[model samples]
Target chain A: MRRMLKLLPIRFLSAALIYLVAGITLGTLDALGYGSFKSVHSHLLAGAFFTLVIMGSMYQLLPTIIGAELKHRSLAEFQFILANLGFISLAYSFLSNYSFLKVAGLIAFISFILFAFEIFATALSVKDFYRRSLAIWFFLAAVVYLVVGSAYALAGVLGITSFSAARHAHILTLGFVAMTNFGGLYELFPMLSLKKLHSRRLGEVHFFIANIAAIGMFLGFPERGNLFILSSLLFLAGFYLFAYNLTRTYFSKSHGPEVEMDISARFMAYALAFGVAGVTAGFTSATLGFPGSFTHVHLILTGWVGLTIVGAMYHIVPMLTWLEKYSTKVGQEGVPLIQDLYNKPLAKALFITLNTTLALFAFSSLLPALSIFAVPLAIAFLVFAVEMLLVLGR
Target chain B: METLDVRGLPHSERPQLILKKLEELGELEILVEVKPVPVITMLESKGYTCEAEQSQGVWRVKIRKKQG
Candidate 1:
């Protein structure tokens, strides 16, 4: 059981790094006037990279955070296998074999069901309602989005239903990816800063508004109508609420020396800024029929989701690795601090370069001549991969 | 039973302080503002027993060396 707890997150994070590289490679190629591989790229990053990281983090943290034993512990390893296979198959279908689409979709759908069931069961076992943090609620909601969005997408893929690809993307992106990140930030920001949430009540309100906006936008997309406009407004409102809540939580007065924001939290702060920018761009693109749709998507996916995962992994990887390697030896001998497990200078470098690359990439979307930024973006991802792998080695 | 108040300590300093205190005292209680899940997990993994309870929004965790 201990070994499973130790190894599961590492396995998932290692896999996410692989997918990140592949996804970024394809994205860079697309930017260089190569054949359009947008579908494959999106699947690799969103379906594989994001999903793997979220699954791994949840498996590791949920038990600790919610004060409940994870239900179906043994099945989590099997679920990981299924998730990887399903995503690989899906990526293959997008790249080459259309016949593999249905099979891939089924496999991935089953994996999603297993994940949702496991998490829901674990959460339900938490008899104490107050112990069930707002983060758990976000996680539960994300898995719901995962199952429903994937089913809808599979139906569309199988020609059983006609729907806009954008709608399916929004379901997974806004509902699943964004919600998971929100939950993570909610949990992590407080823990890292050693502060309680600024407004639990406001967070609850944000959750409902975000969910309604996600569903409303899904129902309203491909048509710039009242529903779409209202949903867009709601979406912005939710984002602002989240931003304000977390900002206050982190910046709230500490009785002792002010808790300095570490590099990890700094990354998250920048990620939230990017999230605000992304949603604003998304609203403009939807309401005004803007030409730079790609800008909004890139900002959200790369700037928002990508940075959040990276930031989280910085803290999580070191802590997990420290727990696995040093926890048992604490009193027996001197043990290295969790912060000492990772290279600080490399982390700082990755932070600066990754954000710079994201800014350049966003600009590149507007000015085609600036597409040269893709090379730096790819390099930044490579640096991230290397930095994370190095942490594992330490 | 010594009571170690770790409310304002940096996260990196908490574990070491707890372990050193445990090594010196054999058993102690910690007062923390947060749940201190990681500390509890580490202590248990290191062959210590821990029980935590909350009162007045503060967590009081008792840690003892496990008896053979």
Candidate 2:
């Protein structure tokens, strides 16, 4: 059961598909005059998709760190129920503005709190200061951020908090979801990139800078534009350090590979570039004091976050589950690395088309409405779906 | 009796770091053994609580009592 619960994180992340669906649905609804903004889509993606990944990663991280047995299998089962119900209620309330949504949201929070307690038990009992501890810290921090954001959203929904939409949205999206994803990268990038961690010191620095920048933006409020600017810069620096370390490590290794391991690595590399572009555009938009700066923000979430997660999915599920090992070896001489589990050429082409076009759309101001951004995104998704089926099901 | 047992210890730290951490967790009395001794012999030398006995290869030690 403990081993089984490990699969839950990825299971929850599959909820992000629901987010993409919501985006398409709410987009159509907007066309139909049901709602104007994509709030429901944003929440479903950031909250449900992101939370599920965090939960799943913990199952692997906790046992590695503490060597303690899971105290309760039922807690995860309850978590699955509460999270889906709460998110569904929240989504409905986003469209209908219903009061029961808050009740459901609160139930979800209570469920996560239980999950937190269980993981925290292992954290306290850990006998060694392992690297996996970093994973747990980020996961817990993400959960805490989730609780704070959810509580705020609940209050706002119930008319207890007044007009805190922008602030709460940033908290839920940037603080909770992004931070959690960053944690997973710290664990995975080393393994999948076929390199040792470049700078352990940077990991600590990045975490501090992230939390500090995030909190600074929160407390300073969005009205103080300069703080957000500073925070974003700090965050961009954090991202650069991460990219630099990863790239340096990738290049430092002396190995020849004609065939790419996972096309997902390209997605990660491109996502970093997109993230940089988003930051640049955001800065440019701010200095220009122009409208539609929010588009750059969404690009950061979708082009960067969305692409990174999808790319990582291409790597993680096959490797971690050892599904790659189950393949036939009759004609194969050298055992393929885990990254070799997928069809890279097709994925690489799709990811390149997907990311390049989408990134260009983010920065495209004068280019008369590239509504075709949706085309590459859908195509990329289809390609990824095929790769996933081939890699995971076989 | 004097003994030394190394199991379930971190590879990076070796016996020295483990002993340091163990020292921080409890009181350790100084008793030197020239040759490799069973864990019981070492525990007896340092007065560690012995609740059971075990052997690895040729060395053996028994923990028969709790140390306060």
Top of the candidates by TM-score: 1
lDDT of 2 at A326: 27
Query: What is residue A42's positional error in candidate 2, in angstroms?
Result: 1.4
lDDT of 1 by residue, B1-68 (tens): 89999886666667777888898899999998656666787788778999888788678999999999
What lDDT score goes with residue A140 in model 2? 66
- Estimate the lDDT of model 1: 0.84
For model 1 chain A, give the 10-residue run with minimal summed lDDT: A1-10
What's the DockQ of model 2? 0.02
